[model samples]
Target: MTPTTIRHACIAALACAAMSASAHGLKPMSDDELSEVSGQALLSLTNQTYDGLDFTRITLGADIQLSANLSKVRLGEYSYTARNGTGADIDMGLFRFGRSDGTEAQRTVNITDPYFEFVYKNAADASKREVIGMRLGFGSIAGDLGVQLNAISGSLLINGGAAGNYDSHNDPLGGKRWDGTTCTSTCGLTLSQIGQLTAGDASGASRDFFISVLRQAVNFPGVNAATGAPDKALEGFWMNWRDRLYAPVLNAAPPPNLPKPPG
Candidate 1:
């Protein structure tokens, strides 16, 4: 064919490819691999052992879409539930998902309806305000110290995008800078006892700080549906929307009663 003719043919092919891409959608590697009814995530509390109570798993799947062109997986109306039917109900709350599995990509992961409930084993003090994401406050996002994304080459199954190099970890409990890591102890406390600890503080305040969300990463290691291999993790994740949350108010009289500083 003549050079002009060949050029025209290439242009047509490129246009066709682009159109096809827009018409189709991409899903996570796990979604493509597993034939289960819904997306699932497994946690090995004792290291790859599920026959015991230490192992926990949850269901994670929704209208998840993937885009190879953007190198991102966007969760559209996604919500994760407890596989055992007695765990937290979590969901991603945002759309513009960026890559979080690289050295320098902006990972802006927003959360919604997040929860966490685990036994606080061996805590030295119980009267102090417990916090998560850090015990000393302020460090690198590379470590699983608090509520952050899974590291590259790790199997944490962050159901979002492939990954870039941006660290965006704004913990709901702590804020942008925090280090007080402590989970509310629920291991041996009865229902009534647990209430005593968090309900009526020494100053007569209530447990309205938050509903206590379990900031966890839905990890599905061992088998991935995408590469058909055991890739430590599926990179990072991102939601496709946002919503407002509501709760009953407490301590409404604080501002009115507190001493006014010198104007």
Candidate 2:
């Protein structure tokens, strides 16, 4: 089954458990009891507000290892741009993580605190309440990301280089070369030339990443795909974050020795 389906199934199971507990006379565990637990919950829900937006966040607490593939993925399709068909910020096919023939560790993506967050504007008014955006992020990730793109409208930087085939002459994949001695302008690298894309830092260290889609287009600074120059591009979808997606610090010190949970 798909990763999304599996995740939703888990959430449904948790909801049913919560309902069953409410239906029965089961009392919630005390903080001390909860503290003694060795494992985290499978799911958690949180609601909050910030910057005039209301956020409903569903977080999956497990540290997961998974392998999956998507036949196609199209995000933020709006106006029809000649260079970007369907006007999508990200339009790709055969998106996959890991390899089928690899070992378990090699074929699996390690993800922590996977979360889905929905942003709403005018949430106080029923008729006016609308979901303005949604995002999927991981507190941290370590994995391989395989994809084939038909078109992309926003910035997707990798290894400190931009992913596109545009040049200052507005040519596709014909911009200043990568040799650094070329046009003395911006360099554009196609997905192929960028090689296998791995989710990590320059040193291959794991890090946080986020993928988001919004109703309103957000202007972001990126290389002009058509002209190979730095410019602002408006897009309603984007992936990868230059900062942390979630925190509490991944390498925080463990608490002092405590009693283990009852067997």
Candidate 3:
């Protein structure tokens, strides 16, 4: 059967399976069980595509703790860009499922490189360092940079060498300067940390700032999965920040557009 037909068949099968599971006295599992089941489902879904095609990679049980009330799940795909830069596309799929037990199951398929990989860390001094490193590599947070800063700004600042300023003598990677003063290895400043320094009611504000910056830097449109509608706030923030910070990178000469001569 053609790939499309197979995909349709798989969807139908999954629907039937779901119904059967519900009918069988199979009570809903806990969050952990649900996560495992959903992860397995997603893998099955991926394999079903193109006659059991294997994925380049699969990251199972990735944790995305958005909040006490929300749960997140993710899947990723990896592939080379097309030779001509015209048809090559990578897939990065994300699934956000709500959870009451701090554990939930979700699934995705045909995902390329995801725009973001949200990670949760324990609340400790060591964890703070880990978060700081992530922020530097991934850019800022998504929603709380105010009207002035956005995701792109955060990305450029972080990946584009903004964090370097925090380092001694402006080293992009924090390292001890020649003079011997150690750079701030733990540069992460949480909302509580910020509140201690600043005055306003900035509870969780640091996280918001980080999210806004990351969204801007990543250039993600924040499309609604159900309706595929553009998230206005996210789009505007990305565009505005891109123009200011990432424009130079975007406008820079692309690698010679040499496509492998029609194989």
Best by lDDT: 2
> What would the per-residue lDDT of candidate 1 be over residues 1-263, giving only the tens digit for each residue?
99999999999999999988976866456764665656434322212431121222222322222211111212212235312111112221111222333222223222222222221222357554322210110000111001121111111112111221111122232111111122112111111111000111133212111111223322222221322322111112211111011111221111111122457
In TM-score terms, candidate 3 sits at 0.17
Alpha carbon deviation, residue 108, candidate 3 (Å): 21
List ranges where model 3 is wrong by over 4 Å. 1-155, 158-235, 239-252
- CA lDDT of each prediction against the hidden true structure: 0.22, 0.53, 0.23
The digit string of per-residue lDDT tens for model 2 on 1-263 reads: 99999999999999999999888977789999988879667898888775556778788887887677776687766665445444565776556665544344557667788889787778577678787777777766776555554554443444433233323233233221112123323534443333244565455434435666767633222211322222222336656433211111122221112222368
Between candidates 1 and 2, the TM-score winner: 2
Across 188-245, the per-residue lDDT of candidate 3 in tens digits comes to: 2111111001101223111111122222212222212322312222211121111111
Q: State the local distance difference test value for candidate 2.
A: 0.53
Q: lDDT: which is higher, 2 or 3? A: 2
Q: Model 3's lDDT to the true fold?
A: 0.23
Quickly count the clashes in candidate 1: 29
All models, RMSD in angstroms = 22.3, 15.7, 22.9
Candidate 1 has its poorest 10 consecutive residues by lDDT at 136-145
User: Which regions of candidate 2 are displaced past 4 Å?
Assistant: 1-39, 82-87, 100-104, 123-128, 160-188, 201-205, 217-235, 241-263
> Model 2, residue 206: displacement in angstroms?
3.9
